[model samples]
Target: MRRFWYLPLWLTLLVTGCAGQAERGDSLYAQLGGEAGVDRIVAGLLWEIAEDSDTRALFVDTDIERFRNKLAEQLCAVADGPCVYSGDSMRETHRHLQVTSAQFNRLVSSLIRVMEQEQIPVGPQNALLQRLAVMHGDIVAD
Candidate 1:
């Protein structure tokens, strides 16, 4: 009888502890400083991309404000935030661009620079990059 009682108690404690750890872990979105933080990071990244001679041409005819908003939405969604990215799929958006691996790498480097400038800790910055890097297949075709 005592063994049975202890079993349930142990299970309950285990579950409770796991739930608390989950809550404490939080989402990457929160770690990235939420929506405002995302905006700041994205803005800095776009600025870097525009100034990077190797990647500037990609945004030559783009509407920067709209791009910023969409990029933020996408980043927020990927970070498990509340935003919904309504932009076209990555493949569809980049299909005609014929983006090369070098170009893609340049953009990623710019993004990393912005993250560093934002003073985002290494863990969260790497986490965000990991999430974004999965889209390389869709964004890089050349």
Candidate 2:
């Protein structure tokens, strides 16, 4: 009977702790200088990927300018910044591509490189990466 009562107390404390941490985490983005910072990171990432021969092939028939713009907007939205993402859903856009996990990992690595270049703090970078990880299932068809 005592153990059952302790369980609820422990669960409540855990929930409250998580809520506090979430609020603190949001402040990290603001400290990093918000939208302008996010844009810089995105631009650098797109440039790096475009320059890489292997990644460039993925966008061979794509309009580079449009792809870059959409990616920036999407990242901004994902980071909880002030931009709206107007791109197609991951499943829809990637359905015809037959992308593999290797391709997805490569793109993630390219983005991480850009984040490092922009000097985004570790916490925000990790937070963003966690969110991106959730999309892997929808993105990598094979």
Candidate 3:
């Protein structure tokens, strides 16, 4: 009876270990459908931001295409995708611009719209958004 119990315990441990490893292997970006998916989401987000009069000023003087590509790359890198994020850090990048929390929240809302439009699976979307949500503190000042 003791030997039987030992075997079951060992099998349970092995199964649990394997499950944890699998979860660990999943990259945030890959879970978001890798590069192609991120591109779609970013494109939609840009469109929404462009149309919003309040947020439009933030992008004035910016080259839309370059900005879009940079954003996609950055998000991909954040998700642990294969791409490298060459952009400056959030604080360094936004320091001169003096972004406000309200503006940041609007931008995040637009991004959420894009994600919904793209129909990205919920689990990855939520996970990515959760990570991004934490950046509000550093990205938005005052």
Candidate 4:
């Protein structure tokens, strides 16, 4: 079982719309520790998924390095960083995978673990997750 560290803080920030943060341009990206920090978070997430039995098989035939780069780009863009994701749309990319809710939740758990490990403050982490969560319907198949 995974521990939901700082979940309340995440919820609070979401409910609050992260007020006062928007006044500063690109603060979310900066608060996310910028390019280096996002890279580390993505790398750590990949490592965690690679090591976990439940998730490892999902990436077996994948080009992990490329996936990492794309993921980092996607996350960076979502966080209002300098990078942009030129990869396929979430729906198009995962259409053939038939991904389940359980798998998606596990991936989210892995992501949260990376954010926690990197000590990315709860607000920024939740903000990013909220943005990413919109893609859930696209990525998960019926």
What TM-score against the true fold does each predicted structure earn?
0.82, 0.75, 0.77, 0.81
Residue 110: error of model 2 in Å?
A: 1.2
User: Best candidate per lDDT, number?
Assistant: 1
Ranking by TM-score: 1, 4, 3, 2
Per residue, candidate 2 scores C-alpha lDDT tens digits across 1-142 of 7658789889999999989977786653463458777768767877877787776667777887887788777777777767798988988877877777877888888888888878877778888888778888888888
Candidate 3 CA-lDDT value:
0.82
For model 4, residues 1-142, the per-residue Cα lDDT tens digits are 2588789879988867745455556567798889999889988998889788777767777888889889989988998888778999999888878888888999999999889989988988899989999999999886
Instruction: For residue 128, give model 1's deviation from the true position in Å.
Output: 0.9
For candidate 1, the lDDT comes to: 0.89
Q: How many backbone clashes does candidate 3 have?
A: 1
Off by over 4 Å in 1: 1-22
lDDT of the candidates, in the order given: 0.89, 0.77, 0.82, 0.86
lDDT of 3 by residue, 56-141 (tens): 88778778888988899889877888889897777777777777888888888888788877777777788888878877767777
Error of 4 at 34 (Å): 0.5
Runs in model 2 with CA error above 4 Å? Answer: 1-32
Clashes of each: 0, 0, 1, 0
TM-score preference between candidates 2 and 4, better one: 4
Candidate 2: clashing pairs of residues:
none
If the candidates were sorted by their lDDT against the true structure, best first, what order would they fall in?
Answer: 1, 4, 3, 2
